[model samples]
Target: MSTSLVVGGSGRTGRRVVERLLAAGRPVAVLSRRPRPAAGVRTIVGDLDDPATWPAALADVDGVVVCVGPPHDAAGAETVVHRGVAALAAAAAERDLRVVLVSQIYVTRPQAHPAMAHVTEARARGEQALRASGADPAVVRPGWLTDEPATGVRLEQGDTGWPTALAALTPDAVAGSL
Candidate 1:
């Protein structure tokens, strides 16, 4: 069976990725700082600051999905997503594994919202690093997420929502897209 490593597995998108991967009969491993239990998914405790734990979590994995978001501070955001994503890409390159990275839509249009500058910059940097790492990356740029449940969701390419679009997406909707 194929194996997948999901970073930020407990977060909005990460958790759903874990669930979907498991449902597809793939071996799932979740990498997070505060690891939690999820049926059918193996949880691995770790963080981006020390990627040493990544090798173990990524062992024999066919693909890696980075769904981790930036931190509150600008520098921290860069470190966690940009630098951390670069590290994951490097690791996947060494093992010849595919990668799927989650990025926000606003990052490309910084002028759309003044408050989103730093985050958008950080996400753009992360995407750049992944593209440079020789890993065939599937970049998912989602719109404003809605917690309004997943009864009906429409996933499309490109930026569909804005900073205040308020069109939140449930984790299941994103999982379905994947």
Candidate 2:
């Protein structure tokens, strides 16, 4: 059986990814700062900012699903998002593992909500870092997430105007895509 690692798997979206992977009969592992015990999932406790804690978690995994978010402090975006993602990407590249990065939409926009500009900038930088890692990673940019059920999902390449109706995307839908 193929094994997959879900970074930030304790978070909402990452949890859903783990669930989907488990349902599909794939052995799954999660990387998080704290342990989350799921019946069929393995948990690895580590800090994303520190690459030294990654080897055991990345070992034997065929692919990775990264759904991490930056720290609340805007100034820490570089360390938490950019460098963290780079570290994961570098490890995956060395092991010849496929990667799927779950990023937010509008990260490439010139402007963003004042409170979110730093995160957007950080995500953009993360995307660049992944591309440069020589891993051929796949990046998914989802719209604002909601607890509501999935409906009328659509996929587009590159940036586009945000949808006026049903702008929210469900975690389940995103997980299915992953």
Candidate 3:
């Protein structure tokens, strides 16, 4: 069976991704700064800022799903989002592993809200880095995430915004898409 690593597996969305993968019967590992023990899942403690910790979690893994997000501090967003995701993409590329990056919709838009500009910029950079890594990765850009129940989902390409009626997407819906 194929084994995959879920980066940021302790976060809200990441947790859902882990559960979805496990339910699908895929062997999974979680990369986190703290230990997260789940039956049939392996947890590898590591920091995204420290490159040395990557290989151990990635070893023998067939793919990776990056669910990490930028820190609240704008200054740290670059390191955590851009640099961190870039590093992960590079390492995954080296191993010929498939990569799925969970990104935000319209992150590169010039009209993004001022309060979220920094994070959007960092996410945009992360997307660029992943594309440049020669990994042919799949990017999932979810609309504002919510805890609402999963009604259904749709996939579209290009710069399309979520309908005004659909205010947010549930983490469960996004995880299932991955």
Candidate 4:
């Protein structure tokens, strides 16, 4: 059976992915700080800053989906996305697992805001780390994401707003990709 470890699996997209995986009869393990009810799914509780607590979840999995994000506080962005993801990539390498990242399209944008500069750069660095970790890495850089209902599904490759791009993927869509 194909097993998947979904980081931040309780968040907007993560939750959906977990549901889809379970529905598909895949062994799904979720890494999240919040304790949610995912009856048949395994929930590993831990923060990105301390992933060591749940090493078992990272072991022997076919694929890992990283949807972790940093806090809005200053300095948390790099610590969470860049540093944390780097560590996760190293661990995944040790386990010989493939990794998939859910990233923002801001890394490819023309302008960078002063407030979000580190966030943008860190996300790029995280991508680089994943690629160099000797694991098959797939990156999904979405535009803006909305929690609202999806009017329809369209997959286009362009400078779609990050939130909009994020909106393009429903939990079901991402789970199918996994």
Best by lDDT: 2
Model 1 regions lying over 4 Å from their true place? 149-178
TM-score of each: 0.83, 0.88, 0.87, 0.79
lDDT of each: 0.81, 0.84, 0.83, 0.78
Kindly list the per-residue Cα lDDT of model 3 for residues 4-51, writing each as its tens digit. 899989888888999999999899999987757999999998876668
- In model 1, the worst 10-residue window by lDDT is 161-170
Residue pairs in collision within model 3: none
Model 3 worst lDDT run, 10 consecutive residues: 159-168
lDDT of 1: 0.81
Off by over 4 Å in 2: 163-178
Better of 1 and 4 by lDDT: 1
- The clash number for model 1 is 4
Pick by TM-score: 1 or 3, better one: 3
Decoy 4 TM-score against native: 0.79
Which regions of candidate 3 deviate over 4 angstroms?
Answer: 163-178
